[model samples]
Target: MTVKVTARGAERWKQGHPWIYRSDVAEEPDKTPGIVQAFDRKGKFLGQALYSPKSEIRLRLLSRGNERIDDFWWSDRILVAARRRNGITATAWRVVHAEGDALPSLVIDKYGPFVVAQLLSAGLESVRRDVLEAIKYALEPEGILLRNDSAVRRHEGLASEVVLAHGQVPQVVEIVEDGVKYLAAPWSGQKTGAFLDQRENRNLIGHQTKTGGRALDLFTYHGSFALHLARNAKEVLAVDQSAEALARGAENAKLNGISNIKWMEANAFDLLRELERRREQFDTIVLDPPAFAKTKANLERAVAGYKEINLRAMKILAPGGMLFTSSCSYHVNRDVFNAMLADAARDSGRRIQFVAATGASSDHPELLNVPETGYLKGMLLRAIG
Candidate 1:
């Protein structure tokens, strides 16, 4: 099958953008979702792409050439993505970061001996068997679970489901990351069992935290950051709205044999305000909230929410204290997130210095050309006054 796109779509491909919207398609193939050759309206071959008849993103460029995209190609791509994480010292990490690894609409995460994958688009779903075999051939993991529950799949006319594709997978899997132990629920946990993108950032906060001082981890789901913070801080408070998640975090703390962390179940926004009103201060603070802006329309409201918590955190920060804040919203670009932080700092009535800007771990590669491949933006700050 072949698809012919308009000049604008052809130019988008020429400019290195991977997606060609449905509106830019001049000629559509009368076929099911699968791999298809893409050409310009002028009959010039542009690339080979994964075609989804129902998606607004009609085509996702797989290769710029007419190279054979078969089982071997799939395995090779998976192997290449795996090789990129050769030196990464973690049992759980993102093996394929969708477009970040040049495998659009597909995500694969490894948790110890098991692997969880999400074929987010109908195009990818059409080649599900090939992709699963490629994962087996490349990684040879003990098991592979298809985590196709993402809301993005609906846009492609695919149903949400979680199925065990191969081998055996446990309900809970133990994995180690940067010398910290934690549990991953691949079948039910958030974003492929846990927020693997923040692996390096958690390590950063762990290393930067001062000893014998109070530390606060707001919205600390499963206590990934809190576990790291507890290693250095005399006392740590890990707050989250989900008591079930806190219980899992407590298990992680027990696994590490660390008892310095206190898990609190509360709304992070409300807690931040309460802490500020009580004049409570902390030497170390981490604000890793869930995406407040799921869509572009929610950007303004997300900025307000982000600023409110950041401003409260800044006000309650002790002199010379460290604060680590981040946003994982794809709509929240780095510039906008930084601008919001600046606004928060100005209103915080505290002198703050930008220590460092942070991002997702190395395994989650971000392409310079594709800004959407990088959604996690963060800042490490220190209070000076």
Candidate 2:
């Protein structure tokens, strides 16, 4: 099967864009869903892609040139990705980051001996067996679990299911990050069991805790950030609506033998507003909320939500306080996020200086050409009264 793409699509592909939307195809192929040879409108060979009939993204280009898309190709790609992460000492790290690793629409995160994989695209689903084989041969993980509960799978006409692809996975896997122990239920937990992307950010906060003062960690999932803050703060408040997550965070703190953290189960927005009204203050504040916008359509509303939380957070920070905030929405680029923070600071009447700006951990590498891979954007700021 050959996919004929429009001139615009051809230009985008030539510019290294991996997706060819349905509207971009000059003519759709009549064959079934599987691999197809992608060509320009002039019938020139452009690349090979996985054709997804039901998706808006009709073609997910796998190779840009004459490269073959065979079992060898899959094995080699998986091997290369595994080799790149050999330097990562942490047991829980992203082994393959979707397009960031040139394997678009597939994510693999390692949690100790067990590896959790997400097949988000129809293309990856078509080659599921081959992918599993490649992963087994390359990494030889003790267990391989498929976490296909992503909502995006609906667009691909695939049912969401979680199952053990290989070996057995414990009810909860224990992972150690920077000396902090965490219990992650990857099969049922959040994205890939934990926000492993925040590994480095948590370490940074742990180091910044040289001043033993009060700290507030809003939207603190599993209390990862709060535990780190507890290392330096005399008292740390970890807030999250999920009682389960707060319990797990409390358990992690107990595992580390740290008891300074106070777990609170309350909606972050409501709690922040209440704190602001009470004129409460904290020496450190961490805002690691979920993605406010998953798509461009929700960008405006997401901006407002981010601005609200950040504004309230800044207003509640004491003088010379440290604030670490992050946005995991790909639609919210660094420039837009920074601008939103600026607006929040201005509205809150807080003088702040961005001491550090960063993104995901090294294990989750960001490709310069593919900005979507750089989804996590963070800023460490100092509030000056």
Candidate 3:
């Protein structure tokens, strides 16, 4: 099948974007889900794309220039992505990052001997056998688990499921990050067990933490930040709304043989407000909430939500305390997030200094052309009276 894209779509693709909207096609190929060659309006070859009739993104280009997406191509792609992270010193890391690796709609995160994969698009989902074969041939992992539960698959008309494609996966796979051991309950915890993207951010916060001081970790899923901060802080309070995640965090803390972390179950928004009312102060604080804006329509609410938490957190910060904040919402761009922080700082009447800016770990590489790949943005700030 061959797809003829409109001028706008062709230009976008030529400029390095991967997705071609359904409205951007001059001629649609057979209404089937599989690989298709895309061409410009002038009949020039654009790229080889995965075409899905049901998706709003009619085509997701897999290759640029003269390239074939064959079995060997798939295997080589996975290998290249793996080699890119050769220097990443961790037992768990993202091997394939969908568009970040030019493999659209495919995510593979390695967890020890087990690998968890998510096929988020019909195009990638259609080649599951080949992908699994490639993964096995390239990584030779003990197990491959397909965690295809993302809501985005609905746009591709695919059902969400979790299947062990290669071998059995342990109930909880143990992974080490920055010398801290964590039992990642795959497909059960948030976003492929734990927020591997925050590995570097957590380490930075741990280093910035003041010794023998109190620390607060908001939205401390699985206690990653809390455990890291525990190394420096005398007492750490880890709070999250999910009881299961709190339990997992406790388990992880135990796994690391550390007991200074105090787990609290509460909604982060309400808890932040309550802590403000009680005048609770911490020497260090971390705000890592979930994506507040899943869509553009929710941007306003997301901004408000972000502002509320940052304002509250800033108010409770002790003088000369350190703050680590992050926004995972791609809709909330860097400028908007920074502006919200600025507003929070002004309203809270505190002088803040930017210490460092950080992003996702090396494992989750971001494509410069595709801004969506850089969803996790964070900063380290110091509060002064």
Give one digit per residue, the lDDT tens place, for model 1 in 126-151: 99999999999999999999999999
Whole-model Cα lDDT per candidate? 0.94, 0.89, 0.89
Estimate the lDDT of model 3: 0.89
Q: Report the candidate with higher TM-score, 1 versus 2.
A: 1
Candidate with the greatest TM-score versus the true structure? 1
Per-model TM-score, in order, reads: 0.99, 0.96, 0.97
> Tens-digit lDDT track for model 3 on 152-227?
8898999989888988887788888789888887867678877889998988999989999999999998899999
TM-score of model number 2: 0.96
Rank the models by TM-score, top first. 1, 3, 2
- On TM-score, the stronger of 2 and 3 is 3
Clashes of each: 0, 0, 0
TM-score of 1: 0.99
Query: How many residue pairs clash in model 3?
Result: 0
Per-candidate RMSD, Å: 0.8, 1.5, 1.3
Off by over 4 Å in 1: none
Best-fitting candidate, scored by lDDT:
1
